[model samples]
Target: MRSSPELATSASLRYVDVWKYYSGKPVLKGVSTEFSPGRVAVLLGPNGSGKSTLMKMSIALVRPDRGYVSIGDRRVDEDPIWARKVVGYVPEDPVLYESLEIVEYLSFVSSIYGIDVPQSRVDAVIRALRLEEHLGKFIGELSHGTKKKVAIASVMLRDPPVLVLDEVFSGLDVESARVVKLWIREKASRGGVVVVSTHILPLAEAVADRVVIIHEGSIKADAPPTKLRELGEELEEVYLKLTGYSAEIEELVRALRG
Candidate 1:
């Protein structure tokens, strides 16, 4: 069993003027941000706001057309393998092998990291996420929420220093979502960097230490959750106000009434 690498306490995820384009249409426009260990930064935005793009950039799954993304001191594009070693990403759309059982899939993922994940660790996560019954089921037979649990378990097994979760609570049930929320808080307390991108307003309100509102590929608001509350705002209100969607929503409502 290969041992996990010792991560530096000061390791951080950074984006510097990062920009990306797909077929000449801009997706990210000079996005810049830094997520440090021991903090949970929630990225909130409407559709097409480049939240997912930024998460992908952090893990080197997508490269920026200009600027750079770094995990600690290593540029993700330049040292993808190293960056991946330190980061565990749970994407919005999780992909798994249909033929493999839950345990089999997790074992395969552990092998890729060359880490011998103990049976106890696997069992613990299964119990925590209420996935024990589904462990023997094939990935193809599992429901969307169950498959999401499998994906999350695989990432958690690695115990990486950095976690980038994009809408992780989407398919989860209420109980499962609550479990994940607590788990994220525990990870943050242990000095791990956690970045979550989601449209789930309540989840953001519950767990976010810092909230970043992105609109049209740019940061519109970045502040601590307490600061927002002090200003008499919730995440939803802040998002609506910063994204300039209040007027558009009113127009839609009026049209519907007409």
Candidate 2:
């Protein structure tokens, strides 16, 4: 396995009273949190609860309407390029150049980062993700899962200080998902900050050092996974309670039984 260079400088992702709106509807309301290096923070929320928006803002893909977001000393709004340089983002829906082959696309990404990495490093990641056979195929000709793998490999090649993954395991196969989970753990062990926005409770349980739950555009709970387990609760139970979905689920189950 390829390893990242020793990152002596520590970095943290911070959201200071951040807020965002779409067509006058608030999506993130006065949200503030910090993600520290050597930890994996998982953001969990129901659909439209701003999980994706938060992840996007961390990498400056979506600017906040109010408040500030910073990665280390660089403000996202003021210095997007510098902020992005420290982040390796896997968007919820990644866009790729259809005409470019997998290798060509990865090379382009490397160029954008202004880094000249050894081909051996690239080969290691491709092989880990089981993409060796498809490296020569055009991205448009690959399956969704294959495309997602390519996107992951591209970002992993950069080995940024901060890694943001939005629903990364959504379309991956069983083995692929397992590989990614292991990768996240390894990254955190090496003092890299990793933020994963996902609804996969099991994945969160496996990797999260801290879990932040968002409900209706605001933070509802922020605690370590052990806290939930200490309360004799599972992640799903805590999610439903904090989000006020227990009653709704009970009602649905009752109606179905009738």
Candidate 3:
């Protein structure tokens, strides 16, 4: 990821009437939304609902076929490397160099981020994620949960203004998951923009300042937790009703809200 002076002050992530297709089928159709600073937004959707695709656009991992994604003033496609510096993205499947020790890999990532994050920040991230002990271990030897923690640590180490995390709680322990929840809320409290995609409804409700339900490449509902609860008690129930699902979101909703 690279930085630019021109984009230094802008971090709001926006997708304006975006569209995407795969094999002639639409994945994200006319998706438009803006993620503002100092807020935690949770995206809830079933598999293949285009949630990941939408999150990837903010960092330029996936470009929209129509419309455009932007971070502040610069269009993501026009300057993806800079967009990356502004957004810290953690994908569902983290890409780790298995051959390297955890410490070695973090040091390499730290170098890539340059002076954007201080060594103290990096150290804090490692400590927060409880990765101190695993630093000497080969990444390949770590458990799935540990690997996930490392990936999260890598991105958080950068201390970017905008964060896009997909299935962030997958493979995490109860304590680690709690820590992540705090991370989300803390970022928003500090005036950073955060987007998190998760299948866990209760956790989602707990961390989000706003909840967005996406289905079949379109938004079914976009509102705060209060507004969502007004639709129903359980978030899954509200999601089911909004997305036209039936019976606990299984019969009417598409798939597991993963």
Candidate 4:
């Protein structure tokens, strides 16, 4: 067993033999994986393939029916509050207090998380996401993309060791997406474990050090982008092939052209 200091700074997230079910339907089945420090892992899966559920498990917003998630020696399911202190999570649909201004909302997060250098960190992220202009506006009044920026800011400001971001780039514009990608790389370079899920294969290809593909409640593939794209295939092509979509797409093409 490690000391408290060591456990608090644990640099990796692990899931072992994890299983989850929704209304008697299995969403994840016997899944086991580990995310290492200094790397960015991209989770790729089609709709209803369980990517979101698996990501949610890392933060303990949802727990597995079996198995467990952990950071170093501490089990996330067993010590979720401790886990939250070390992991910064951005969900698929971020929930923020509608009536609060951007700065007030972030102040609330800062207080809740006990951030060490709250104002400086918040200022840095605000500038990075170009939110300085909207800091006084109520969170409810911002556009979806701007609101998403605030959500990203809330997590990134913490600079936590483990980050579980679900569809982070969905509403972001091109430049904001590019900036966030750079931030992701910077975070990983500093030895933070970053796991992001996205449907944009090109974006995933650009950001991922390794890719894990889930399909129908099982891990269909896991490999570095280069290996997954063997023989000069694109990441999208590889994903389609691995997830059994290539054949269906071919059938669609034939029918449409006929």
Candidate 5:
């Protein structure tokens, strides 16, 4: 079992009976969760499970319809700018400035954060993310993995107290992914809150101080991984069971493998 380099203090990000909708269709139905600073928290779910929506609410990108989402003591909706400043968000599919070169793109983001020392900071992030080879390239010309690296590097450069990552490692190559994982650990260790959503159970199992299983826009399980899985259970099995797809999917998977 891997351990978080820093233990989170209890007062981090918390959601209370949060509800949201799209086109009059319910997305998150009374979902509530808490995340702590100085630790890594992960949300796990299948497609359309509202994991991304939850991250959006935390960063004040989208407003909740019924409940409240808070970062530390302040409510997101009530203080959007402050909330955004304190949090760093990376979406699953990132959009970059096509007209700008990679280094220039990063410089622009730093400017939004009111970050001076732009050159040194950009250089440090580029080196850390191994983006030196692609720095000269225009944003549109970069590969998907390289683009993902740039987006992630931009968020990390902000060095906010809260980090919200939606499927952050999906497009990263193995080496880059390792570097990101290490960076996440270091950031959380130094008193930042990192909330990551991924389909990769191993990644979550490896780094998360706590795991949250969201299904049908509600939490089905929330606990430490070891505590979540009893001696005879795996995390996937528990997830399958909670979602009522365990037996059916298992049979199909076995048939395919066999």
Candidate 6:
């Protein structure tokens, strides 16, 4: 039985024996993991470790070819729409209407999410993202970093129980990235579950409560960054060692020297 949404806040996001394939090629295979509220989870992997695929499964954007994904006691596939109602996703590069003003775009997104909050909610997000100056401008006129901020604000406006961000800090300048970090931290403090996937090890180390590394469709390591510090000189060093990227780093240096 599910605890009431107010009481539970988190529903224990879990994936069990999950598998996914693309064009006859397998991506995720027998993957199992769990995520809960009030914590930030970071997913790390090389270019093809199915990190994106796993997020897709959690958000009900893609179905697993085998196995299951569940929130607490409810199966995701059984009611994808309902499942999505509790999840908010911000993709690596969010596409917005170039013709619409930022405010208009936000209004449209909030309507789609069925958020009936007061305009103050939207105003808060705009201020938090530092989007006030650009809200009146057409999205086409905004810079890439500002566009990313707008996308993040759109996701926050819903105040969903779960947030999945894919490289969300990639294009932002240092200050904007810091703002995002604080915003996400506040959400986690409020008992929201946040999962972010990124290749930037330092940023993930800074903000994530737990780090999960995937290699070749399998979890290579999963632990708190502090816990990882005991096993390695630093989290990044252990990540590279575990993911077999240390060899690649040496080869790249050699090639560069050549």
TM-score of each: 0.95, 0.94, 0.90, 0.93, 0.90, 0.91
Per-residue lDDT of model 4, residues 193-236, tens digit only: 89999999899999999999999989988899999889336888
Q: Which residue runs does candidate 1 get wrong by more than 4 Å?
A: 1-3, 230-232, 255-258
Worst 10 residues of 6 by lDDT: 1-10
What is candidate 6's lDDT per residue for 1-258, written digit by digit as tens? 121133266577899999998899888879999988899999999888999889888768889999999887889899787777777788887889899998899879777766665687778877777888886799999998888888898777777788889889988878778888887788789888889998888899989999999998889889999998887898888988989989999999999999
lDDT of 5 by residue, 23-78 (tens): 99888999877888778998999899899999989778888999999876788899
What lDDT would each prediction earn against the true structure?
A: 0.88, 0.87, 0.85, 0.85, 0.83, 0.84
Which has the higher lDDT value, candidate number 2 or candidate number 5? 2
- Identify the runs in model 5 with alpha carbons over 4 angstroms from their true place: 1-11, 251-258
- TM-score winner, 2 or 5: 2
Q: Among all windows of ten consecutive residues in candidate 2, which has the lowest summed lDDT?
A: 1-10
Worst lDDT 10-window in candidate 1: 229-238
Residue 178 of model 2 has an lDDT of 88
* RMSD score of candidate 3 (Å): 4.1
Which stretches in model 2 have alpha-carbon errors above 4 Å?
1-8
Put down candidate 2 lDDT per residue, 1-258, tens digits, no spaces.
333333345768899999999999999999999999999999999999999999999868899999999877778889887777778889877899999999999989888878787998988988889998897789999998888899999888888878999999888888888889998999899889899988889989899999999998999988999886665468898889889998899999999999
Candidate 5 local Cα displacement, residue 216, angstroms: 0.8
Ranking by lDDT: 1, 2, 4, 3, 6, 5
Worst 10 residues of 5 by lDDT: 1-10
Quality of model 5 by C-alpha lDDT:
0.83
lDDT of 3 by residue, 1-258 (tens): 432122333467899999999999999999999888888999998899999999988878899999999888889999988888778889998889999987778778767767355667778877788888888899999998899998898876767788899999999888889989998899888778899999999899899989999999999889998998987777878887876665654643556544
Model 2: number of backbone collisions: 0
